[model samples]
Target: MSVTNQTTVTEFILLGFPGPSSLKLTLFVTFLAVYLLSFMGNTLIMFLILMDSTLQTPMYIFLGNLSFLEIWYTTATVPKLLATCLLETVTIPVSGCIAQYYFFFSLGATECILLAVMAYDRHVAVNRPLHYSVLMSIEICLRFSAGSWTGGFIAPLLPTILISHLNFCGPQKIDHFFCDSDPIFKLSCSDTFLAEALGYTCSSVVILTSFLVTMSSYGKIVVTIIKLSSREARKKTFSTCASHLTVVTIYYGTIIFAYVRPPAKYNFTIGKVISVFYCVVTPLVNPLIYTLRNKDVMKAFQKFLAQKRFLLTRNMHKF
Candidate 1:
């Protein structure tokens, strides 16, 4: 293959949501609010997991890792998107754009594996109740969590490196909020057949494999739940998995719609809307779902608040 002359594209102007000035401000404010809430929610989960001794189980440990991933995942792209909404023309340097794409996808891949690991954890908890503690010991949980992080970080490296080396001759305006692989690849002037092939191959392997594992774990969980004689037992068991199932459904649904297809068939507007759901909405809602549905989390939160109030009252009396 003959090498095309490398493009002089130094920066990419992000053509964020195209609309009236009022719409821009509205989007900016909306995204800013979402980002802030996502940040706070994830941070709170991490903090609670760290502070509450009762939450030192394998489930919460995995959750803490997930919260950490969510914080950085949203951080990778949301701020830049917010900036583009506010500024008339927001340009990211080529290197910065590449880095953003790499991290965004890497973090997302990490979440994918993490979710599957969470499913397996739940499966073992429900299926092997007698050996739950033994099966999911601290060391084992750490290994699973570490594997997710490592796999997530390494999964996109090859594709990202391949795409980065491709030539972008001109037309550096990306018609989306962030520097995603599809948008960036579209801008490349070089022959992108190999890059595209590699991307699809990697995505299929990561997404399909992780998704299958999660589904299989849930499948076994469903079978085990069915064997429970008491309605209450079954209901309680289902509740434990409910929040995770909801999150997995929303996350994988949006991701499958967005990336698991040929780029030629991609609808930019639809993709952007779905991207907002997974990228912006899911992270914000995850903690809410888990905390609200979880009795333990609620009890812990109330206890934390009560402790703070008691401390304040005592301090005031002393003063």
Candidate 2:
């Protein structure tokens, strides 16, 4: 194979949501709201899981980490997107693009494995309640969380490194809101086939493998739910799993659509629409779906509020 030794590309211009200049402010405000809510909501959940002694179980521990990941994950892309929409120029240096994709992929990859581990936690809890603590012990939880973070960053790193070495001759524009791999790859003047192929292989490792594990865990869980003798018990179990299943399915479906599928001549309009779901909507809903509906978390939140009120009243009396 022949190689081109040429000047390396230094920067890229992002072609954010395609629309009239008139609409930029509108889009900015809307997505800004999303980004803020996603960050604050996830942050609040993380705090609750940490401060509330009632949430020391294996499940809440994982959920807390997931909330933290969601906050960082959305932060990876949303701030840049907001800036691009409102700033004078949407240019990002080559290094910046790499950094963005790195964190984005890291947090994304972490979430994939994290979700699977959470599913496994649910399975152990529901199907083997007596042994739940034994199976998902503190040590085991730490390992699983560490593995997920490790797994998330391992595969995607090399290809982006490969991309970093490539030359970009002309057309320094990235036709997406952020430095998505596909959009950035298009900016490269060099042949990107090998880079894309490597990326696809890496994606399979992080995405397909983790997805299969999660699905298998859930399958056994469903069977156990059916075998449950009491209808009330079955209802409670299904209720616990349903929200998780919804978020997982939506997150995976969008990922498969955006990344697992081959790169195409994307209609930026449609791409931006789908991007909203994964980047914005999922992050916004993650903490809510996982913890907001949870009775234990709600009870803990109420208790915290009561204590805060009591403290305020006592301080006022002393003053």
Candidate 3:
């Protein structure tokens, strides 16, 4: 490729949900509330897993890693989106834009891998209950978690680097709330076929491989459940993985809809709506999904609250 008179753009204006002032204000308030709630919910999950001994098992260790990831995952984009809602002129430097895209997609990749790991964890617990301890020991779980983080962070690096080197000769307005790959690519003057191809390939590898691993693990789990003789036993076993299945379905559905296709085919408007579901809504609902029906988590939470109450009562008696 050749470039002539490269007046490379330095900054990008994010056209985030353009509308009347009333609409902007409404969006601002709505996103701000969602962001706060998502942050708190994920943080609480991490804290609970850390503080409660009952939650220190392999399953909850994976969950704690997920909670920690969700915190950074949402943080990578939501705050900037909130700014875009409120600010009339929201601009991010080119470097900053690339950084945002990297972190957002990196965390997304991490979640995919982590979810697959969690699925494998579930499969081991269900299919090989006797070997669960040996297979999913805390040390092994920690290694898997660390591997997910490392792979996720590394996966996006090449595509991001290539995209960063592209020349954005003009038209610095990105028609999205945040620095997504498609919107940024749309603004580039350089020939983007190779870069886009690479980006999509890397993304597809992360998404599809992990998705297949999760599905395969779950398939084995389903087979194992079906082998059980008692009807109640099958029902009981399926319930253990039901929450994970729900999360995987929602996460993979929205993510595949948003990212699997070529950027050239994207309708940014529809993409934005889908983005809201996975990027914003999914994180908000995850803690609730994991904890609401979980008897162990409920009991642990009650115990924690009871301990706090007992301490307060003891202090009052001392006074």
Best by lDDT: 3
Model 3 agreement with the true structure over 1-319: per-residue lDDT tens digits:
3458767789999888878989989988988888888889889888889999889999999989998998898888888788888888889999999999999999999999999999999999999999999999999999999999999999999999998888887789998988998998888888888889999999999999999999999999999998999999999999999988998999999999888986778998998888888888889888888888778888888888999999999999999
Per-prediction TM-score, please?
Answer: 0.97, 0.94, 0.97
Ranking of models by lDDT:
3, 1, 2
Candidate 1: list runs displaced more than 4 Å: 1-7
lDDT of 2 by residue, 190-260 (tens): 78888888887788678888899889989998999999899999999988888788889989888877777
lDDT of 2: 0.84
lDDT of 3: 0.91
| Whole-model lDDT per candidate | 0.89, 0.84, 0.91
TM-score of 2: 0.94
TM-score of decoy 1: 0.97
Work out candidate 2's RMSD over C-alphas: 2.0
